[model samples]
Target: MSVAAAWARCDERVVARQTLITFVGLRDPYAHDPHEDGRHKGPILTLLDERSFDRVILLGRPHRADHSERTRQALKELHPKLSVQVIGLELADATHHPEILAKLRVVLARIRRDGPDDEWSVSLISGTPEMHACWVLLAVAGELGAKLLNFRRTVHNGIAGPRFVRELGWGEPLASLRPETLALLSTRRDRWDDVDQQGAAHTPPRHYFSRAILELAVNLSRHLAPLLVKGEPGTQKHLFASLVHQFSNRASGPLLIFNCATVPADLFETVLLGEEGDGGDGKLRQADGGTLVLIKAQELPAPLLARLLKAVDDGHYFRARGRTPVKVNVRLILTTERDFEEEVRLGHLPVEIWRRLRTALITLPPLRERPGDVLRLAKDELERLNRTLPRPKRFSPAALAKLESHRWPSNVSELRRVIEHAVLTAEEPAIQPEDLDFELAVNLANVFTAAVPRLREGFSMMDYLRAMKLELVRGALRKTGGNQSKAARLLGLTPQAVSQILRQTEARE
Candidate 1:
C-alpha cells in the first residue's frame, strides 16, 4: 500500500478533518487496484467541502505491465477538483518523459504564483521507482507555499495501513536528508551550513554593515583604498572585505583572503607570494587579477611587510622558490588594529608602502561610536543562526538593550559568539539577559560603570549625541554618493527628516 493510503487508514479522524489532501504514490501493483480509489480522494474531497480539508494528495500505483489506464481515467473522473501528477519511471530522458516532473513543476509554480486557497485539492500518483521522487515533490510544495504534512504508515496483520499523522514542512525533515537535497532547497541554507561547518563566520551582508564601513568599501573599490578598521575583536572586518569584493569590478573574480596574524612569518612570504612546490602557485599569483585581503596585516614582520608593500606598488613579485618575476594584477586590502601611520613612523612599515596606502584611507569607528547599528547586527545574526539549528530563538527587548549598552570590544564577531553560545545553552525559546554568559555580562557592566562617571561629570551628552548623529548622516551621504532618498533609508529616517537634520547640522557648524 502507498504512504497516502496507509495515512488515510490509520488516522481517519485527522485525514477526514483536512480541507485539502495531496495523495502521493510510489510505483506499486496495489496502486492500480480500482477498489483502492477512496483512500486519498474521497476522504480529502469530503473534508475540504466540509471545511475539514483544504487539500489532499493520493499516491497511485506505478504503471507496469499489468497496470491499466483505467485507474488514471477513474481518478480523473472521480477527483476533478484534485490535481493529478504522474511520477514516471523513466529516468533515461527527462526531456522526453517530462509529464510527471513537468506537471509537478506547473503545480508548484501555480502555488508559487497564486497561493493555496479554498478552491483546489492537490494529489500525486507515482510508482515504486519514484520513491525518492518525494524530494522533488516536496520542493515543489515548498515553492508553491504549501505546508507539508508528515503521514506515517502502520501495518496490521501484514497489511499496510495509514495510521500516524503529523505535519512538518521542508525545514526539519529536509535538513535530515542528504546534503544534495539541502543544496537544492534554498541557496541561503546551503551557504549557511557550509560556512558554519567550515568554521567560517560571515560578516553581515551590505544591508547590515555600518554606513561608514559601506562607504569605506565603496571608496576602496574606486581606488586601492587602504582602510584601518579599528574596532574591538568582532567588528566584522572579514564582512567588510566581502563588501569591498561585492562592490569592486572584480566582484566575479577570486577573493583571496589570509589572516596574517594566524599564519607563521615563514609561511607568510610563501603564502602571499606563492611557491612552486605542492603543485601550486603562490598567493600573489593566485590573487593576481583580484583582491588580496590581509587580515591583521600589522602583525607581519617588517621584512615581509616591505616585500608585500613592494608587490602592492610594483604589481609584481619574484617568488622565493623560483626566480621568474610574475606580474600580478592585484588590489591590496589590509586590516589592522594599530595606527598605520604610527607604525610607519615607528619603522614597522616602509615609508614607500605608506605612500601607496595614503591615497585611500578609511578609519572604521568602534562599535561604541555606532550604537544604532548594534540592534541591526543582532537581528541579522539571529536570522542567520536560526537556519542551522532545530528550534527557533529570538532576542528579547531587554536583551537587545543590554547588548546596546555594552561596549562591543570584540565587535560583531564577539557578539555572534556570545549570541550563538547563549542560543546553544538556553533552555527556553527566547534568549534573555540571564542566558548571557557571566564573563560577557561582567565586561558589559564594567563599560556601563566607566561611562556613568563621565556622564555624571557633565560629559556633554548633547554634543556627543549630535556628533554621532552627524557621523552617521555623513557616512550615509557618503555611501549613497549624496542620494538623499537612499541615505534617508540608510539612516532609518524620512527623506525630509534626513534633509532637515543635515540642514540643522550645517547651520550649527
Candidate 2:
C-alpha cells in the first residue's frame, strides 16, 4: 500500500539556507528507475528537486566516478543557478567505515574551514550504509553542525515522487561518548587548524611551490616595479619576499637574498653584481629571470645604491674587471629596518628612490596589532608541536586565553620561542596557564622602587615625572618594534598622546 508524505505545504516552498553535500551512488545519474513505480524520478535528481540547496557537493569513489561528470552536468542544466562540484576520492572499499570517515573528515574540514558560517545539510539517502553511519557520527559529534536530511520515495494520491525529511531524531549527548572517543573528537581539525604555514611566523615554503597569503602584498607581486618592504626585525619581511617571489611569473626561476647589513658597501658591486674571472659570477646573473631580495638595503652606500638602481633600470650591469655587460631580468625586492623618515630628515636618502619607496612600500605591522591572528597562530603552533609528543597536548581555555591576551612585544619570533618552551616544558598532555613563559618588556614598580631609593634635594618633581614618562614611552616603543599604536596601548594612552610625548622627547633631544 502507498501512503501520502502528510506534509503538503512544502510542495512549492523552498528552503532559504542551503548547501547540500552527498555521495554519488550508482543510480545517481539516472533521472528515473524504470522498474520501480514510485522511484520513477530516481534517487539523486528527484531528491534534489524536493530539497533545497544552493551549493552541491557530489563525493565520488574512485571506481564509481564514471557518472560523476554526467550527474554534475545534468544538475547544472536543471538548476542553472546552483553551484556544483564533483570531488573524486580514493576510497575503493565502500564498506570500510574508518577510511570513509577519514577521507570525509578531510573534505568536510576544508569546507568548514573555508566558510564556517555557511549553512549546510547532509543527505543520507544516496551513499552506502557504512557511509550513512559515518555522516550520523559526524553530525552527532557536532563536527557537522549540519542539518540531517533523508529522502522518502512513495506513491501519494496517484503522484509518485520523493519527499525530503529533515528530522533524524537526536542522539545522546557527547558526554555519553567514551572518554577516548570524546578525546578523538576533541582532536578533530578545527577552522584554525590550517593557519597559513608561511605567515609572520617565518615558516619557509618549499622552493618549488608557491604559498601565497591573502594579503595586500600578494597583489604587488608579478609586477616589474622596484618594491620596498619595511618593518621591524620580526615583521615578516623575509616571508613576504618569499611569498612575492613564489607567486611571481618568475617563480620557476631562482630566488637570491643578499643581506646588505652582513656585507660591506665595498663588496655590494662585486657580491651583488658579481666580478669577472677570478672575482665570481654575481647574484644578478644567478637570479636571471627570477627575484633578488636585498635585506637591509639602506646599508648600501649612496654611490653603490646609485649604481645598483642604474643596473636595475638599464637591465644590465658590468661585472668587476669585465668588459662585457651582464644583462639580467630580475625583480628587485628590497627590505629594510632603517627609519626612512629619519633618513629623509638627514638628507641621506636619494629623492627618486625615496619617492619609489614611499609609493611601492609594504609595511608589516607588529604582532600586537593583529589580535585575531594571535590565537590562530598559537593554536597552529601547538598542533605542530604535538605531532612530536608521545601523547597529543591540549591547552586549557585559560591557557589559550592567556596566549591571546599577551601583547607579543617581540612579534612572531617571540611567539615561536614561547610556544616551543611551553610544549617542551609542559609535564602533562594538557598545558595550563602557568606553563606559558612570557618575556615581559618592563617592570615599572620594581624599576621605580629600585632606581629611586630616596629623592635628592635637587631632584625636581616635574623633571622626575617627565623623565619617567619618557623612559616608559621609549621602552614601550622598543618592545613593540617602534609601533606607535601598540606603544600607546601598552602605556594606557591614545596614539595622539603617544605622538605628542614622542615630539616632546625629540624636541628635548
lDDT scores in order: 0.55, 0.68
* Model 2 lDDT on a 0 to 1 scale: 0.68
Candidate 2: residue pairs that collide: none
Predicted structure 2, TM vs. truth? 0.48
For each candidate in turn, give its C-alpha RMSD to the true structure in angstroms.
Answer: 19.8, 21.5
Q: Tell me the tens digit of each residue's lDDT in model 2 across 1-509.
A: 22344344454344344688888876776744355555444456766877767889899876777778878988989899999988887886876777888999899988776556668887776766667767777776767778766643222222333344544543554435543333222222111111222112222422111112323444676477778888766666876787676545665577787778778657778887778887777777787888888888889886677677677778998888789988878788889988776787799987766876676777777778777778877876676556445688888899999988998776776776577656655677788988786754224333443555367788788877778888889976776678786566556577899899889888988
lDDT of 2 at 440: 41
Any runs in candidate 1 off by more than 4 Å, and if so which? Answer: 1-204, 224-230, 275-280, 438-509
Looking at model 2, residue 86 earns an lDDT score of 86
